[model samples]
Target chain A: MTPRKTDFPLDQCRCHLETGPIVLVGSQWQTERNLMVMGWHMMLGFTPAHFGCLITAANHSHRLVRESRECTINIPTLELADAVVGVGNSDGDALDKFDAFGLTPASGKIVSAPLVEECYASFECRLVDDSQIDRHELFIWEIVKAHVDTSIDLPRTLHYRGHGRFMVAGDEIDRSADFRVQNL
Target chain B: MTPRKTDFPLDQCRCHLETGPIVLVGSQWQTERNLMVMGWHMMLGFTPAHFGCLITAANHSHRLVRESRECTINIPTLELADAVVGVGNSDGDALDKFDAFGLTPASGKIVSAPLVEECYASFECRLVDDSQIDRHELFIWEIVKAHVDTSIDLPRTLHYRGHGRFMVAGDEIDRSADFRVQNL
Candidate 1:
């Protein structure tokens, strides 16, 4: 059986990071021959599915964002939440995240973004629209490829709320097909 | 102790439904109400931040989309995944899901659609933009109010893939303040 991840204590983040998971979006610079990481990100669509990640104009990944435009959304499960969060603090401008974190980069089919093998779910997204994102450095892209490890029995996800806190998504909580308002 | 949700299954309907959740737009007639469950949802902004979900015209929630133009997005935890999916399955045009699925509705802070208490989180969304949706029904709204059960030790989320399969968001795999990646 695949071992369940347990290092991340995300309840602290959920109560703190009220927004969502702290993710890492990375891409390679054609000029630099390296990849950079990002923290500000969110899902865009499912039909022609995509992702929208907010990057500061100065972040190293921001440069790659312009260079590659395509990036990978690496979902850090329990084992990588800490390291994943660390990427938020580590600047790709100064340091290469892949070299510092020991993460392996895999080739993606739909987009130019490199997939992080250590993370369970990797989404390949390309540009779609960002009419309102100039001030915030926001870029929305369509998800071309999404792959998950079916071997892992339990479902897990990580979200970044604000600061140090990280929210952890636990196993299934199947409510009855018949919903009861009284329980609320 | 809160029970672990083992019965809920992951959905593969990401392409068709979008990667967002539904906000309860009010029903048109007393006989039946419309609710738009979106899939192109995201946790984008963080400071004074909110989430964004998409609703397509083809969706049964279209009536809820048209009449009230306001609704609540009750976050369904593992326990409520089945009901969420079921609501996604049964159309409001043909039936009253609130009654058919035994979903209890509560008044919203901003919208008219009832909020399901069974869900772990709830968000009230108001219609903002309709320009982007082409063949799909798109309603862009700001997440006003959000709620979650205080009892859950660890909060997990549901990721929609498409079809009936929904992946449960899991816990943290690792924690890193300064994350770095290396080209493998």
Candidate 2:
């Protein structure tokens, strides 16, 4: 089911990404478009909403994102498990993942890359640094805009554990009382 | 109780870390030793067992790791939740985290940095690239040796969310049958 999403605050992006769930990265350059499942990513900074992820040059989406200098980071829930697995296993070059996986593509506010409408959240990102691309295939991006389905209080996100295994985002433990105000 | 750990295969380190659990980073240089809770880390390579993490220079352990060029990435379970929060909230430079939190500091086989005996796993690491450190405060390290408690088939790891909240690692979904052999 496609979710009705609202604009999200850029600084609060860490709240959603820091936990590290497997994301479907959407990319497009002129006529070519693709989606790749990525797990190796981390929040770099909060103010500029910097995010870093490794996308090897071997992937079909690599060149598209490199040329476009933009992409969409979409957070899929447990319901999209099959699509996530399918996207990761198949090559994006030969397949139209959006059509094959039955996912809806929505136009982004800032980036040309399409966002997956079925996802719980989608962040439109622009590449901020390309220096590490040649050496590490790491793309540093600044999230320009974010859209989130805030209705889903606790989205059951998928976290990849390699070898075709995954761990679902589970019960929340609120330890706010234990934390220092400054730390929080 | 501290579980007895055996040497783990370096190539399969992704199985444990790719899931993106918050880890306790251990570092020591001369008389100064510190522990910092780190969530911004990712696997870079398998053969050389490369791992990349961001440690801003403001962190006390950052200087220790930078000077010594070594650190230990320790994976703690839900059992050590308080210790994890304590280490993160308090200043590492002023306090002995291991002693204060009642975590045993075991000597590493390869690196001078001590490993937390209470953790489910500990990987001794050596700094591989310092080029990004000055520019991004990103440290690239190669896992020299890894130790894991194989007895625990499933570890309840803590994934940090902002505002002192956490998501405990949950149920496993094994879709190995659905996966392509090469992709798996």
TM-scores, all candidates, are 0.68, 0.99
Query: Could you tell me the lDDT of residue B128 within candidate 1?
Result: 59
Chain B alone, candidate 2, TM-score of 0.98
lDDT of 2 by residue, A1-184 (tens): 6889999999999888988899999999999899999998988888899999999999999999999999999999899999999898898889899999888889998899999999999999999999999987889999999999999978899998888999999998988898999878
lDDT of 1 by residue, B1-184 (tens): 2222221111211111122323233344344466544444554444434334545566766655555656666555565555566676666778777777666776655666676655655555565555445533444555555554545644455654333334555543333333334310
Which residue window of length 10 is worst by lDDT in model 1 chain B? Answer: B7-16
Q: Per-prediction interface RMSD?
A: 10.1, 0.8
lDDT: worst 10-residue window of model 1 chain A = A9-18
User: How well is each residue in B1-184 modelled by candidate 2, as lDDT tens digits?
Assistant: 8979999999999889988899999999999999999998888888898899999989999999999999999999999999999999899878899999999999999899999999999999999999989877899999999999989877899998889999998988998899999888
On lDDT, the candidate that comes out on top is 2
Give Cα distance to truth, residue B140, candidate 2, Å.
0.8
Q: Number of the top candidate by TM-score?
A: 2
Best by DockQ: 2
